[model samples]
Target: MDDLYDFQESFSYKLVKSETTSVIPSSVRKFQINFNFSFELDVSEWILSEDDESQLVSQSHHPVVDCLVSMSSAQFSSFEESQKYMEEKLTTTSSGLSRLKSSNRRELVDYALREAGKYTAGGGAHRVLNLHFDVLLEHEYIYLRDISNYDESTRHMVPAEDSSIDHALKTVEYSLDIPEMNCSVCLESLSGDDYYREELLSMPCAHIFHGDCIKKWLRTSHYCPLCRFEIPID
Candidate 1:
């Protein structure tokens, strides 16, 4: 009875023969029961797939990270080219400036020699030096006053009576040999025109003049033609 109650309460069962083996012993065998359990795990599904929507979302949030950066490279290249160009220009300008300085000094020396030679040959070095002293001072060359101090005897070398007469004779001979001087008004070389022969004014200072030029000059002030020696206007 107890075994019947136990079999009714549970489905699992085991069959065994009694120890006294009242029934056939070999006919009964033991049977064991077990409960089987299983669980389904879904691991194949992806959390974030590689699709167009996912790529678009990533690009929209951080666009600069994916963009190409080349502006700095282009700017650097331009700067290098500009630096080379400036260096080339500087080299050319420096050489040109050096040549210009050399040529200017040469021209100044030549000009000084020509003017000085004229005064020395004309026997008017003192007067010529006085006139051009200011020019020398402006150019920052040696001053004429300094030179005069070195040659104290030069102050007494003015033309004397006999020397003046000799100079006049030599000048007359030279004038006869030379072609008639140019007319200052017309700037044309004169060949003793009738207008110049009668009325032309020859300044006591060294310059020859046309009658008209002298009349115009006398209207302003009484002075010698070349040097500004005061004279009677009349």
Candidate 2:
């Protein structure tokens, strides 16, 4: 199971605001950085049998970790000092970074610190930066078969056509029309600032997902997540 799973990680940063507060003395640079993480898992299994049509297939997705971590910058002059500071700050946090490999964690922290440093070069006494990280691990189990005797039934999922995807893109909508709900992909709440800030895509079956999440999903399959409603492929 461990060898069959693939792990992926990504990091993004946004400078929320940089202001010189009169309350805080200009001599002090109070740099604050917040970290938000969304962790997910995708599991797939296939059991082949003598009867191709009788093969058992199962797939599921759910959030594994979702949490926020924040750290306030201390006075650091050199690059090495900054790196050490970030590593210490993140190590004490309760974020998903603790679960990642030491090397992976270092890479993520290094990248984030570098990005944050870019804007803090000439910032006011108070500068706030928000960083979002996504960690995904996909696990799959399938019987090993001889390529000479390959079968089409082995391929379960089909990719949608480009035209069909375009139509779906045009159907992007918001969740404000409906009551509070969760996006099936990321498992995050809808009808809030997150969904409102970004458009949500609605399938023909009336199921809605985060625009970015559904866009990534549509790249691999045309079926609606919940109802499996097929968007016609031209």
Candidate 3:
């Protein structure tokens, strides 16, 4: 195991609760697994530009952590086939977690497959995982140290200007559909009648929030309420 940060692993799986049939014209069920890889890095010396006159110096930069770092999926008609495919995937080029030891890696794959097997075979597919990881990166000549509690807040966030917030709201005005999720800002539903829909706004990071709530939030913090994704600011 890599000794950069303490590795903690846990997973959750559920049947994709939809009556909608598979897109493929087959009887086999498909499973989609998404991996969430988290890393702690020491970027204090990681400067984007050396010159103060450079336009890059004025732009905001934040490490992407909440998005889908990688995705892997396969269809299996039978449990045995799925287990076999996962076992063989460990040694294949398409395996996502190839950096770990064989013994530990196999254990994870087996555990995931076993959980997946519990569901009915002909059900409407399954979704598994939101796995977390810690990685260490070292260059031959450059050595980077690890920092504790590394995040955008560690460097401080600059409050976004009115122009940027206005632009974000305008984009949402043209959107045809608002997501079913709750707004992280007001902790309320973003979907409902047309009145509620008009009150919804989405940031560039795609996190939706109530228009008034997010407008107030961006005045003090430029980070997304849910993911800490940074937005352009003064």
Using Cα atoms with residue i matched to residue i, what is each candidate's TM-score against the true structure? 0.22, 0.40, 0.32
Q: Which is better, 1 or 2, measured by lDDT?
A: 2
The digit string of per-residue lDDT tens for model 1 on 79-108 reads 444334323332232111111233433343
Backbone clash count, each prediction separately:
0, 0, 0
Off by over 4 Å in 2: 1-41, 45-47, 51-63, 67-154, 169-179, 192-196
Query: Mind giving the per-residue lDDT tens digits that candidate 2 earns over 63-139?
Result: 56565655567633466776776676555443334444577567766766676676568764545566666666554
Model 2, position 124: C-alpha lDDT score: 46
Instruction: Sort the candidates on lDDT, descending order.
Output: 2, 3, 1
Better-scoring candidate (lDDT), 2 or 3 = 2
Residues 1-234 of candidate 3: C-alpha lDDT, one tens digit per residue:
002212233322222322222343353234444333332121212212223221111122222222123223544445566656655553332112333356655565555555444443445444443343333221111112233333454333357878877876544553445433555544344565665454667787777777888888788667675555766775
TM-score, ranked from best to worst: 2, 3, 1
**Candidate 1, superposed: residue stretches over 4 Å from native:** 1-175, 178-180, 184-186, 192-198
List the global CA lDDT of all models: 0.27, 0.56, 0.45
Model 1, residue 211: distance off in Å is 1.7
